[model samples]
Target chain A: EADIYQTPRYLVIGTGKKITLECSQTMGHDKMYWYQQDPGMELHLIHYSYGVNSTEKGDLSSESTVSRIRTEHFPLTLESARPSHTSQYLCASSGTYNEQFFGPGTRLTVL
Target chain B: GESVGLHLPTLSVQEGDNSIINCAYSNSASDYFIWYKQESGKGPQFIIDIRSNMDKRQGQRVTVLLNKTVKHLSLQIAATQPGDSAVYFCAESRGFQKLVFGTGTRLLVSP
Candidate 1:
Protein backbone atom coordinates (compact mmCIF):
# COMPACT_ATOMS: atom_id res chain seq x y z
CA GLU A 1 0.00 0.00 0.00
CA ALA A 2 1.11 3.63 -0.59
CA ASP A 3 2.39 5.63 2.32
CA ILE A 4 0.58 8.82 1.34
CA TYR A 5 -2.07 10.17 3.68
CA GLN A 6 -4.60 13.02 3.76
CA THR A 7 -6.30 14.41 6.81
CA PRO A 8 -10.02 15.15 7.41
CA ARG A 9 -11.36 12.85 4.72
CA TYR A 10 -14.46 15.05 4.69
CA LEU A 11 -14.84 18.74 5.40
CA VAL A 12 -17.80 21.10 5.48
CA ILE A 13 -17.49 24.81 6.03
CA GLY A 14 -19.17 28.09 5.31
CA THR A 15 -18.10 30.47 2.60
CA GLY A 16 -15.11 32.71 3.36
CA LYS A 17 -13.61 30.27 5.81
CA LYS A 18 -9.92 29.61 5.46
CA ILE A 19 -9.16 25.93 5.33
CA THR A 20 -5.97 23.93 4.98
CA LEU A 21 -5.92 20.43 3.61
CA GLU A 22 -3.01 18.37 4.84
CA CYS A 23 -1.00 15.90 2.80
CA SER A 24 1.97 13.85 3.79
CA GLN A 25 3.99 10.97 2.38
CA THR A 26 6.57 8.63 3.86
CA MET A 27 7.96 7.42 0.54
CA GLY A 28 10.60 10.17 0.33
CA HIS A 29 9.47 11.17 -3.11
CA ASP A 30 10.62 14.45 -4.61
CA LYS A 31 7.48 15.00 -6.64
CA MET A 32 4.22 15.87 -4.93
CA TYR A 33 1.00 16.96 -6.58
CA TRP A 34 -2.49 18.20 -5.75
CA TYR A 35 -5.45 17.52 -7.97
CA GLN A 36 -9.09 18.62 -7.84
CA GLN A 37 -11.75 16.21 -8.97
CA ASP A 38 -15.50 16.49 -9.12
CA PRO A 39 -17.72 13.50 -8.48
CA GLY A 40 -17.28 11.04 -11.35
CA MET A 41 -15.33 13.60 -13.37
CA GLU A 42 -11.80 13.94 -14.67
CA LEU A 43 -9.10 15.12 -12.32
CA HIS A 44 -7.47 18.48 -12.88
CA LEU A 45 -4.06 19.33 -11.60
CA ILE A 46 -3.98 22.45 -9.44
CA HIS A 47 -0.54 22.53 -7.88
CA TYR A 48 2.70 20.55 -7.73
CA SER A 49 6.10 20.66 -6.11
CA TYR A 50 9.30 19.24 -7.49
CA GLY A 51 11.02 19.33 -4.11
CA VAL A 52 11.40 21.48 -1.05
CA ASN A 53 10.83 25.18 -1.79
CA SER A 54 9.93 24.35 -5.39
CA THR A 55 6.32 24.86 -6.31
CA GLU A 56 4.51 25.34 -9.61
CA LYS A 57 0.99 25.87 -10.86
CA GLY A 58 -0.68 23.11 -12.84
CA ASP A 59 -2.92 23.06 -15.89
CA LEU A 60 -6.06 24.14 -14.08
CA SER A 61 -6.52 27.50 -12.46
CA SER A 62 -7.07 27.22 -8.74
CA GLU A 63 -7.49 29.63 -5.87
CA SER A 64 -5.59 27.39 -3.49
CA THR A 65 -1.89 27.72 -2.71
CA VAL A 66 0.60 25.03 -1.77
CA SER A 67 3.85 25.00 0.16
CA ARG A 68 6.55 22.35 0.19
CA ILE A 69 8.76 23.24 3.10
CA ARG A 70 9.52 19.58 3.80
CA THR A 71 9.82 16.70 1.39
CA GLU A 72 7.14 14.68 3.12
CA HIS A 73 4.57 17.41 3.46
CA PHE A 74 2.69 19.38 0.80
CA PRO A 75 -0.34 21.16 2.12
CA LEU A 76 -2.90 23.16 0.17
CA THR A 77 -4.62 26.19 1.62
CA LEU A 78 -7.61 28.11 0.45
CA GLU A 79 -7.64 31.68 1.67
CA SER A 80 -11.37 32.05 1.30
CA ALA A 81 -13.23 28.89 0.54
CA ARG A 82 -16.22 29.31 -1.68
CA PRO A 83 -18.91 27.05 -2.95
CA SER A 84 -17.11 26.72 -6.25
CA HIS A 85 -14.03 25.47 -4.46
CA THR A 86 -15.94 22.57 -3.03
CA SER A 87 -14.66 19.34 -4.55
CA GLN A 88 -12.47 16.37 -3.84
CA TYR A 89 -8.86 17.30 -3.26
CA LEU A 90 -6.42 14.50 -3.92
CA CYS A 91 -2.78 14.36 -2.97
CA ALA A 92 -0.18 12.25 -4.75
CA SER A 93 3.53 11.49 -4.67
CA SER A 94 5.69 10.10 -7.42
CA GLY A 95 9.24 8.93 -8.02
CA THR A 96 11.41 8.87 -11.13
CA TYR A 97 9.08 6.78 -13.28
CA ASN A 98 6.13 9.14 -12.60
CA GLU A 99 3.75 6.48 -11.34
CA GLN A 100 1.87 8.56 -8.77
CA PHE A 101 0.62 7.01 -5.55
CA PHE A 102 -2.44 8.82 -4.27
CA GLY A 103 -3.83 9.41 -0.81
CA PRO A 104 -7.43 8.93 0.20
CA GLY A 105 -8.87 12.23 -1.00
CA THR A 106 -10.39 14.99 1.13
CA ARG A 107 -13.91 15.83 0.10
CA LEU A 108 -14.72 19.45 0.80
CA THR A 109 -18.14 21.01 0.94
CA VAL A 110 -18.51 24.78 1.17
CA LEU A 111 -21.99 25.67 2.28
CA GLY B 1 -3.36 22.81 -25.71
CA GLU B 2 -2.93 19.11 -25.08
CA SER B 3 -5.57 16.97 -23.49
CA VAL B 4 -6.33 13.33 -22.82
CA GLY B 5 -9.84 11.89 -23.16
CA LEU B 6 -11.71 8.63 -23.03
CA HIS B 7 -13.86 7.22 -25.79
CA LEU B 8 -16.47 5.81 -23.47
CA PRO B 9 -17.66 7.46 -20.30
CA THR B 10 -18.97 4.18 -18.89
CA LEU B 11 -18.31 0.51 -19.51
CA SER B 12 -20.34 -2.45 -18.27
CA VAL B 13 -18.87 -5.93 -17.99
CA GLN B 14 -19.71 -9.25 -16.40
CA GLU B 15 -17.73 -11.05 -13.78
CA GLY B 16 -15.05 -13.49 -15.02
CA ASP B 17 -14.88 -11.67 -18.37
CA ASN B 18 -12.18 -9.52 -19.81
CA SER B 19 -12.59 -5.75 -19.73
CA ILE B 20 -10.94 -3.08 -21.82
CA ILE B 21 -10.91 0.72 -21.30
CA ASN B 22 -9.59 3.04 -23.99
CA CYS B 23 -8.09 6.53 -23.93
CA ALA B 24 -6.77 8.93 -26.53
CA TYR B 25 -4.24 11.67 -26.00
CA SER B 26 -3.72 14.65 -28.27
CA ASN B 27 -0.09 15.23 -27.43
CA SER B 28 2.19 12.90 -29.34
CA ALA B 29 5.13 14.11 -27.30
CA SER B 30 3.87 12.37 -24.18
CA ASP B 31 6.38 9.64 -23.39
CA TYR B 32 4.95 7.99 -20.30
CA PHE B 33 1.43 6.73 -19.77
CA ILE B 34 -0.27 5.37 -16.67
CA TRP B 35 -3.57 3.83 -15.61
CA TYR B 36 -5.31 4.56 -12.30
CA LYS B 37 -8.32 3.08 -10.54
CA GLN B 38 -10.47 5.19 -8.21
CA GLU B 39 -13.20 3.77 -6.07
CA SER B 40 -16.08 5.74 -4.61
CA GLY B 41 -15.01 7.96 -1.72
CA LYS B 42 -11.34 7.08 -2.25
CA GLY B 43 -8.30 8.39 -4.00
CA PRO B 44 -7.05 7.09 -7.30
CA GLN B 45 -4.81 4.05 -7.03
CA PHE B 46 -2.00 3.33 -9.43
CA ILE B 47 -2.86 0.36 -11.58
CA ILE B 48 -0.25 0.09 -14.35
CA ASP B 49 1.95 2.14 -16.65
CA ILE B 50 3.76 1.93 -19.99
CA ARG B 51 6.61 3.94 -21.44
CA SER B 52 6.58 5.16 -25.03
CA ASN B 53 9.47 2.91 -25.93
CA MET B 54 7.43 -0.24 -25.35
CA ASP B 55 4.07 -1.27 -26.75
CA LYS B 56 2.83 -3.41 -23.89
CA ARG B 57 3.35 -4.08 -20.22
CA GLN B 58 1.60 -6.46 -17.88
CA GLY B 59 0.96 -6.71 -14.19
CA GLN B 60 -0.96 -9.22 -12.09
CA ARG B 61 -4.14 -9.78 -14.11
CA VAL B 62 -3.78 -6.34 -15.71
CA THR B 63 -2.16 -5.23 -18.95
CA VAL B 64 -1.44 -1.82 -20.46
CA LEU B 65 -1.10 -1.35 -24.18
CA LEU B 66 0.28 1.74 -25.85
CA ASN B 67 -0.04 2.62 -29.50
CA LYS B 68 2.02 5.73 -30.11
CA THR B 69 1.13 5.71 -33.76
CA VAL B 70 -2.42 6.71 -32.95
CA LYS B 71 -1.65 8.23 -29.59
CA HIS B 72 -3.92 5.73 -27.96
CA LEU B 73 -3.62 3.81 -24.70
CA SER B 74 -5.67 0.99 -23.24
CA LEU B 75 -6.06 -0.94 -20.02
CA GLN B 76 -7.12 -4.57 -19.97
CA ILE B 77 -8.30 -6.44 -16.93
CA ALA B 78 -8.60 -10.22 -16.99
CA ALA B 79 -11.34 -12.08 -15.14
CA THR B 80 -13.05 -8.93 -14.06
CA GLN B 81 -14.38 -9.15 -10.53
CA PRO B 82 -16.72 -7.11 -8.38
CA GLY B 83 -13.71 -5.58 -6.75
CA ASP B 84 -12.71 -4.18 -10.12
CA SER B 85 -15.77 -1.98 -10.34
CA ALA B 86 -14.50 1.58 -10.23
CA VAL B 87 -13.51 4.57 -12.30
CA TYR B 88 -10.51 3.97 -14.55
CA PHE B 89 -8.39 6.89 -15.73
CA CYS B 90 -5.49 7.19 -18.17
CA ALA B 91 -2.81 9.81 -17.74
CA GLU B 92 0.02 10.86 -20.04
CA SER B 93 3.19 12.78 -19.39
CA ARG B 94 6.08 14.01 -21.49
CA GLY B 95 9.68 13.71 -20.31
CA PHE B 96 8.55 12.81 -16.81
CA GLN B 97 6.86 16.13 -16.35
CA LYS B 98 3.40 16.77 -14.92
CA LEU B 99 0.69 14.43 -16.11
CA VAL B 100 -2.42 15.16 -18.16
CA PHE B 101 -5.26 13.00 -16.96
CA GLY B 102 -8.09 11.85 -19.18
CA THR B 103 -11.76 11.94 -18.34
CA GLY B 104 -12.35 8.70 -16.47
CA THR B 105 -14.45 5.74 -17.57
CA ARG B 106 -16.63 4.11 -14.95
CA LEU B 107 -16.39 0.32 -14.98
CA LEU B 108 -19.47 -1.51 -13.77
CA VAL B 109 -18.93 -5.20 -13.17
CA SER B 110 -21.96 -7.35 -12.53
CA PRO B 111 -22.32 -10.96 -11.46
Candidate 2:
Protein backbone atom coordinates (compact mmCIF):
# COMPACT_ATOMS: atom_id res chain seq x y z
CA GLU A 1 0.00 0.00 0.00
CA ALA A 2 1.11 3.60 -0.58
CA ASP A 3 2.26 5.32 2.58
CA ILE A 4 1.08 8.86 1.83
CA TYR A 5 -1.07 10.81 4.30
CA GLN A 6 -2.87 14.17 4.53
CA THR A 7 -4.11 15.99 7.61
CA PRO A 8 -7.51 17.63 8.19
CA ARG A 9 -9.46 15.34 5.89
CA TYR A 10 -12.06 18.11 5.81
CA LEU A 11 -11.94 21.80 6.64
CA VAL A 12 -14.53 24.58 6.86
CA ILE A 13 -13.70 28.21 7.38
CA GLY A 14 -14.92 31.73 6.73
CA THR A 15 -13.92 33.85 3.81
CA GLY A 16 -10.56 35.66 3.94
CA LYS A 17 -9.30 33.31 6.62
CA LYS A 18 -5.93 31.75 6.17
CA ILE A 19 -5.62 27.98 5.96
CA THR A 20 -2.92 25.43 5.48
CA LEU A 21 -3.16 21.84 4.16
CA GLU A 22 -0.56 19.35 5.23
CA CYS A 23 0.75 16.39 3.18
CA SER A 24 3.36 13.81 4.04
CA GLN A 25 4.67 10.52 2.76
CA THR A 26 6.67 7.71 4.35
CA MET A 27 7.81 6.21 1.06
CA GLY A 28 10.73 8.59 0.73
CA HIS A 29 9.67 9.95 -2.64
CA ASP A 30 11.48 12.75 -4.42
CA LYS A 31 8.56 14.22 -6.35
CA MET A 32 5.42 15.60 -4.74
CA TYR A 33 2.39 17.40 -6.20
CA TRP A 34 -0.76 19.22 -5.15
CA TYR A 35 -3.90 19.27 -7.30
CA GLN A 36 -7.28 20.96 -7.09
CA GLN A 37 -10.39 19.07 -8.13
CA ASP A 38 -14.04 19.98 -8.14
CA PRO A 39 -16.90 17.52 -7.84
CA GLY A 40 -16.90 15.18 -10.84
CA MET A 41 -14.66 17.60 -12.72
CA GLU A 42 -11.15 17.72 -14.06
CA LEU A 43 -8.14 17.86 -11.78
CA HIS A 44 -6.15 21.08 -12.10
CA LEU A 45 -2.50 21.02 -11.27
CA ILE A 46 -1.84 23.71 -8.69
CA HIS A 47 1.65 23.15 -7.41
CA TYR A 48 4.46 20.61 -7.54
CA SER A 49 7.93 20.03 -6.14
CA TYR A 50 10.87 18.03 -7.35
CA GLY A 51 12.43 17.64 -3.91
CA VAL A 52 13.25 19.59 -0.80
CA ASN A 53 13.64 23.35 -1.40
CA SER A 54 12.27 22.95 -4.94
CA THR A 55 8.86 24.18 -5.99
CA GLU A 56 7.14 25.04 -9.26
CA LYS A 57 3.77 26.33 -10.39
CA GLY A 58 1.61 24.00 -12.42
CA ASP A 59 -0.28 24.72 -15.64
CA LEU A 60 -3.29 26.18 -13.85
CA SER A 61 -2.89 29.39 -11.90
CA SER A 62 -3.73 29.05 -8.23
CA GLU A 63 -3.59 31.51 -5.36
CA SER A 64 -2.22 28.90 -2.97
CA THR A 65 1.46 28.42 -2.23
CA VAL A 66 3.34 25.25 -1.38
CA SER A 67 6.64 24.47 0.28
CA ARG A 68 8.78 21.32 0.29
CA ILE A 69 10.82 21.59 3.45
CA ARG A 70 11.76 17.90 3.71
CA THR A 71 11.71 14.95 1.36
CA GLU A 72 8.66 13.57 3.17
CA HIS A 73 6.60 16.74 3.58
CA PHE A 74 4.78 19.08 1.21
CA PRO A 75 2.26 21.58 2.49
CA LEU A 76 -0.08 24.04 0.73
CA THR A 77 -1.20 27.35 2.20
CA LEU A 78 -3.92 29.76 1.25
CA GLU A 79 -3.33 33.33 2.37
CA SER A 80 -6.96 34.39 2.07
CA ALA A 81 -9.57 31.74 1.51
CA ARG A 82 -12.51 32.40 -0.75
CA PRO A 83 -15.66 30.57 -1.68
CA SER A 84 -14.12 29.81 -5.02
CA HIS A 85 -11.20 28.12 -3.30
CA THR A 86 -13.47 25.55 -1.74
CA SER A 87 -12.77 22.21 -3.36
CA GLN A 88 -10.91 18.95 -2.88
CA TYR A 89 -7.15 19.23 -2.62
CA LEU A 90 -5.27 16.03 -3.45
CA CYS A 91 -1.67 15.34 -2.56
CA ALA A 92 0.40 12.86 -4.51
CA SER A 93 3.93 11.47 -4.49
CA SER A 94 5.86 9.52 -7.05
CA GLY A 95 9.28 7.95 -7.19
CA THR A 96 11.39 7.33 -10.28
CA TYR A 97 8.84 4.68 -11.14
CA ASN A 98 5.90 5.13 -13.50
CA GLU A 99 2.81 5.59 -11.32
CA GLN A 100 1.85 8.10 -8.63
CA PHE A 101 0.23 7.33 -5.30
CA PHE A 102 -2.31 9.75 -3.83
CA GLY A 103 -3.51 10.68 -0.38
CA PRO A 104 -7.10 10.46 0.86
CA GLY A 105 -7.48 14.21 0.02
CA THR A 106 -8.59 17.26 1.95
CA ARG A 107 -11.98 18.80 1.30
CA LEU A 108 -11.87 22.54 2.01
CA THR A 109 -14.92 24.70 2.28
CA VAL A 110 -14.83 28.48 2.60
CA LEU A 111 -18.13 29.92 3.52
CA GLY B 1 -5.01 24.33 -24.40
CA GLU B 2 -3.12 21.13 -24.99
CA SER B 3 -4.28 18.51 -22.54
CA VAL B 4 -5.77 15.07 -21.97
CA GLY B 5 -9.56 14.58 -21.87
CA LEU B 6 -12.17 11.87 -21.49
CA HIS B 7 -14.81 11.35 -24.10
CA LEU B 8 -17.53 10.22 -21.75
CA PRO B 9 -18.45 12.11 -18.62
CA THR B 10 -20.17 9.06 -17.12
CA LEU B 11 -20.69 5.40 -17.88
CA SER B 12 -23.03 2.88 -16.32
CA VAL B 13 -22.62 -0.86 -16.57
CA GLN B 14 -24.50 -3.78 -15.12
CA GLU B 15 -22.76 -6.22 -12.86
CA GLY B 16 -20.87 -9.01 -14.63
CA ASP B 17 -20.74 -6.91 -17.77
CA ASN B 18 -17.78 -5.32 -19.48
CA SER B 19 -17.20 -1.56 -19.38
CA ILE B 20 -14.98 0.66 -21.44
CA ILE B 21 -13.75 4.21 -20.76
CA ASN B 22 -12.08 6.28 -23.42
CA CYS B 23 -9.64 9.17 -23.29
CA ALA B 24 -7.96 11.46 -25.83
CA TYR B 25 -4.74 13.39 -25.39
CA SER B 26 -3.32 16.15 -27.55
CA ASN B 27 0.37 15.71 -26.81
CA SER B 28 1.84 13.34 -29.33
CA ALA B 29 5.16 13.43 -27.58
CA SER B 30 3.73 11.86 -24.45
CA ASP B 31 5.46 8.55 -23.99
CA TYR B 32 3.62 7.19 -20.98
CA PHE B 33 -0.08 6.93 -20.07
CA ILE B 34 -1.75 5.89 -16.84
CA TRP B 35 -5.28 5.09 -15.65
CA TYR B 36 -6.47 5.92 -12.14
CA LYS B 37 -9.58 5.20 -10.08
CA GLN B 38 -10.91 7.62 -7.47
CA GLU B 39 -13.61 6.63 -5.01
CA SER B 40 -15.95 9.15 -3.48
CA GLY B 41 -14.20 11.66 -1.20
CA LYS B 42 -10.82 10.13 -1.94
CA GLY B 43 -7.87 10.75 -4.20
CA PRO B 44 -7.08 8.75 -7.31
CA GLN B 45 -5.44 5.34 -7.12
CA PHE B 46 -3.27 3.94 -9.85
CA ILE B 47 -4.99 1.19 -11.83
CA ILE B 48 -2.72 0.48 -14.75
CA ASP B 49 -0.40 2.08 -17.29
CA ILE B 50 0.91 1.63 -20.81
CA ARG B 51 4.03 2.87 -22.56
CA SER B 52 4.05 4.45 -26.03
CA ASN B 53 5.71 1.43 -27.57
CA MET B 54 3.05 -0.95 -26.30
CA ASP B 55 -0.52 -1.02 -27.49
CA LYS B 56 -2.00 -3.04 -24.65
CA ARG B 57 -1.37 -3.98 -21.04
CA GLN B 58 -3.44 -5.83 -18.51
CA GLY B 59 -3.71 -6.17 -14.74
CA GLN B 60 -6.04 -8.64 -13.09
CA ARG B 61 -9.48 -7.83 -14.58
CA VAL B 62 -8.40 -4.46 -15.99
CA THR B 63 -6.91 -3.73 -19.37
CA VAL B 64 -5.33 -0.61 -20.86
CA LEU B 65 -4.94 0.14 -24.53
CA LEU B 66 -2.79 2.88 -26.00
CA ASN B 67 -3.06 4.15 -29.56
CA LYS B 68 -0.36 6.64 -30.32
CA THR B 69 -1.46 7.05 -33.94
CA VAL B 70 -4.78 8.49 -32.81
CA LYS B 71 -3.51 9.95 -29.56
CA HIS B 72 -6.15 7.95 -27.78
CA LEU B 73 -6.23 5.57 -24.83
CA SER B 74 -8.80 3.31 -23.21
CA LEU B 75 -9.50 1.30 -20.06
CA GLN B 76 -11.59 -1.84 -19.93
CA ILE B 77 -12.89 -3.59 -16.87
CA ALA B 78 -14.33 -7.07 -17.07
CA ALA B 79 -16.91 -8.66 -14.78
CA THR B 80 -17.75 -5.30 -13.38
CA GLN B 81 -18.83 -5.10 -9.78
CA PRO B 82 -20.41 -2.49 -7.53
CA GLY B 83 -17.09 -1.71 -5.94
CA ASP B 84 -15.94 -0.51 -9.34
CA SER B 85 -18.04 2.64 -9.04
CA ALA B 86 -15.77 5.63 -9.09
CA VAL B 87 -14.27 8.36 -11.22
CA TYR B 88 -11.66 7.28 -13.73
CA PHE B 89 -8.86 9.45 -15.13
CA CYS B 90 -6.22 9.04 -17.79
CA ALA B 91 -2.93 10.92 -17.64
CA GLU B 92 -0.13 11.48 -20.11
CA SER B 93 3.48 12.42 -19.48
CA ARG B 94 6.60 13.14 -21.44
CA GLY B 95 10.20 12.93 -20.21
CA PHE B 96 8.79 11.71 -16.86
CA GLN B 97 7.87 15.21 -15.67
CA LYS B 98 4.50 16.45 -14.50
CA LEU B 99 1.54 14.46 -15.77
CA VAL B 100 -1.42 16.05 -17.55
CA PHE B 101 -4.63 14.53 -16.26
CA GLY B 102 -7.70 14.09 -18.41
CA THR B 103 -11.21 15.20 -17.57
CA GLY B 104 -12.63 12.52 -15.27
CA THR B 105 -15.17 9.84 -16.23
CA ARG B 106 -17.56 8.55 -13.60
CA LEU B 107 -18.21 4.82 -13.67
CA LEU B 108 -21.40 3.68 -11.97
CA VAL B 109 -21.66 -0.07 -11.77
CA SER B 110 -25.09 -1.49 -11.11
CA PRO B 111 -25.87 -4.79 -9.46
Best by TM-score: 2
How well docked is model 2, in DockQ terms?
A: 0.43
Candidate 1's TM-score: 0.93
lDDT of 1 by residue, A4-109 (tens): 9999899999999999999999999999999988887788899999999999999889889999999999999999999888889999999887789899999999
**Who wins the lDDT comparison?**
1
Candidate-wise lDDT, in order: 0.91, 0.90
TM-score of each: 0.93, 0.94
**Highest DockQ scorer:** 1
Location of the lowest summed lDDT over 10 successive residues in candidate 2 chain A? A36-45
TM-score of 2: 0.94
Which pairs clash in model 1?
none
RMSD of each: 3.4, 3.2
Instruction: Residues B1-111, candidate 2: write the lDDT tens digits.
Output: 123323448899999999999999989999999999999898999999988989999999999999889999999999999999999999999987778888879999988
Give the CA lDDT, 0 to 100, for residue B51 in model 1: 87
Q: How would the docking of model 1 be graded?
A: acceptable
Clashing pairs in 2: none
DockQ of each: 0.44, 0.43
